[model samples]
Target: MDWFTIKNIDAIDSPALVIYKDRVIENIQLLKGMVEGKVEQLRPHVKTNKIAEVCSMMLDGGITKFKCATIAEAEMLAMIKAPDVLLSYQPVGPKAKRLAALVEKYPATKFSTVIDNIHAAEYLSQVFSEKKLFINLFIDLNTGMNRTGIIPEHATQLFEAVQLLPSIKIIGLHAYDGQIRDTDLTLRKHNVDKAFSKVLILAATIEALSKEPLTIVAGGSPTFPVYADRKEVECSPGTFIFWDWGYKQTMPDEPFNYAALVITRVISIVDEHTITTDLGHKSVAAENPFPRVHFLNAPEATPISQSEEHLVAKVPDASLFKTGDVLYGVPVHICPTVALYERAIVIENNTAVQEWKVIARDRKITV
Candidate 1:
């Protein structure tokens, strides 16, 4: 089987992360078209591409609102001077203090976070109150994805309790429908409508009781398209920045292209049919099973095993590939895989142009 090789594969170090800038720009444009030019309705999550350059690219495309999963990600957005930012993850202990400090430091940027319980809200209020500051918050609604959100029934109570805290202002509701992964667009929309119906009801009830306007940020990569057109919902899709193999196969309807790839080299030939590459668990996300990476050149190759620094795959004819030959692979899960790398080589016009630092990969930022 023939494999696609990079133009300057010999120049790049082995197991390097590659980002196609032109494709990323194309993706941004496609998403913009998906939302019908209403860029404000798209609050892309920065957890996918943690690079500030990507954030700047989004800003250049008229996307200002951003969502992130860590303090460091939020800091990266703030550093970019993004008009609005949401720390999608709930913080505790020093993280909470650090969040308030982040808000204090970036006064020009609007900062918000998600909360499911009163304790987190109260703690954040106390932390911000000590600093004579306030932070915006959205109540995370558990719409079937029982990860980090309050159930719809308890949202009203949480909203009321949060209002009492002077330092934290209730902005809206956040519902992450990550579990809505039906490949069929119709079935996917059905699941999204059913799950988001609860969010809508809860939002209406909270708004009626509080007599305040509220924005709803709902859905992840899968359900973003379903909610993008809704008048009351702001879609926060992360993986759209760099489409991966998993979503490409699962959601074939999504027009986004793969903007990221892993460039690895064959290190050893185990036998006539078996070979090992430098791409490994540390290079790509191992959370998924074998075939974590889809080889663009050798589509028939089957991944057998993966270690910290190597991936073993059995090909129809391993002799076709020699040691030191570069291979391009699209990761099954690009988000976590991105966090594993410290930097990515930015490719433009099929040539390496620059490097983008994955600054937000770290868990903390010195605010």
Candidate 2:
């Protein structure tokens, strides 16, 4: 009768992803509640759950806008007829053209992307202009993540230059404060406010020049609570859909349940203190060190090493386990772990009901 227990799990193959249908719905509700039922401000990123059916569930719950990292995720949202989709990544070269094609194909859905530099913006302008199309853009700000974004000090100049591009329109600012994930809520907010002060100044400067209010999209799961109270900003939290062990440990304040897991079985008995499972590097997110996956059934089984096909673990007593014994595990990182599987077995009321294809996991889906 446990929440993650599947009575008919024997039908599911080993090293497969499984989603609890009801828990996913609960997580969506929790996300909406954080914004006080303001679904308009909830532009969730679909990178965690790439399945079309999962996105539809968010749509059914009155979420219209979405954020994605790739063109395929955008197309998947469009396929579900999502009202608005933002490709958070800056597209250059062929990516810009493929995005333009997606826009033309899904006329009903409004698509936007982020730009950090004028070169990328002008290139996108050329690509969209050739197709006789216009695209909306958000100025990407680097809020200490040092990833792919322009610093706030020099962003005004870049924003002004991008304004001259005819094929692209400046919609707003996109600042991902992904680096502000302190466990203490007060300290986390202070850091977020400190970094976002520059963003606010940049927004004010741009708004004065454009003579229009600018939309601000910001934050991920760890910093979601900090940005949730800001009535004007759109919060993009992806992993809340399928809560993982990483965030669950790091962001203890956010009370999202673990809704997805990898079900694997013991393949061999290595020694009295060691055993191996089918959950390997190919089955889960192996970027982190040992304990990449925590076995829900056998919490003491510590992962010692992982290869492409198997994960060796140090258990208290291997005699307690046998071949074909199933072990439900929660991955430390679920986003990339999800991309490893093509489908997820949907569990409803402790029974495996159906399979939901991880369609958007592919790089190209008829873009």
Candidate 3:
């Protein structure tokens, strides 16, 4: 698989993001090794690459348990009726109400949702009860993200609320602790270890009082190395399959073969100091200082800035490329940038071989 490299994505089309399947599998296998086949569960996050083929590969690699960020992704997977699928995001308001309806239809499927607010918990309790659904309820503990989840201390209260509901069975605790850490290696390690330690305490507390043992779900793409070996529950980390520039540098040795590369054509060689390509922010997420450029015969170049349909990059020896030359860009944010395209043109050595559908991709989720 490593012998086959993506040929030339630019020759195929523009405004396209390409995925190399073999490399992706290599990436998954690399991460899988880090877990040492020791973790009780391994649920790969589907947000990074929503294509069923990629999910199938992860499933093949002893990751039957899968996590998704959207109700739509879960609903789509439920349509296929995939086993052990957990909606990792907090399901609040009417959306979960609509989503809860899905559970009754597929009782064989194991579906889980995260709860942080008692109101949301109470809402789910009623919704699941009304639907006659048996849901594996999880307490979303905010280890470090500070965006969602109840505090670690409040997890027990949320667990108690599930008991009150009766329909929602307390099953797990989830926290994606990677986002809070900075680029610093030691800081990332300390933050990830601290977050998981808190989750460990919550899990122990739940077990001490409740008859049912609680499963802990932690780790993200960046911090999986820290939490993967932990004795706690399972691991679900996205972006590891196709790591971005930010993550590639951070985890240099980790497997990142499955990453996507956007192939762009050099449209305007504005000057010696600046070169322009067909792709821009609309095609790739330019969150980093610049986009990483990977031309076939040349070294990597960085996009200085982007416009609606054009990318202005800083490149040396721009004389080789005319207006018709091609360039490939590795996006900064793998998750969000993957969302920018409708479908991924999967390639092997510059030839378009397969098409992967990006399922359940909704930008605006109305709560």
| Ranking of all candidate structures by their TM-score, best first | 2, 1, 3
Question: lDDT per residue, candidate 1, 48-161, as tens digits?
Answer: 999999999999999999999899999999988998999889888898989888988998899999899999998999999999998889998888987889999888988887
TM per candidate comes to 0.98, 0.99, 0.90
Clashes of each: 1, 0, 10
List the candidate numbers ranked by lDDT, top first.
2, 1, 3
- Determine the C-alpha RMSD for candidate 1 after optimal superposition of all C-alphas: 1.6
Q: What does candidate 2's lDDT look like per residue over 215-326, in tens digits?
A: 9999999999999999889999999999999999989999899999999999999989999999988999999988899999999999999999999999989999999999
lDDT of 3 by residue, 1-367 (tens): 2332445444577868888777787887787778786534577788888676777777667666778888767766665557888888877776677667767666666888888877887888788777777677788888767888888887887677668775777788888775644566577777777667878887888998897787888877777666776756587778888877667766654566536877777888787767788887788776666544444444545566778898887777678678867665666677878888888888766577888877656643231
- Stretches of candidate 2 off by over 4 Å are none
Please report, as a residue range, the 10-residue window in candidate 1 with the lowest summed lDDT.
1-10
Which candidate achieves the best TM-score against the true structure? 2
Candidates 1 and 3 compared: the better one by TM-score is 1
Query: Between candidates 2 and 3, which one is better according to lDDT?
Result: 2
Which portions of model 3 miss their true places by more than 4 Å? 1-11, 38-40, 180-187, 292-300, 362-367
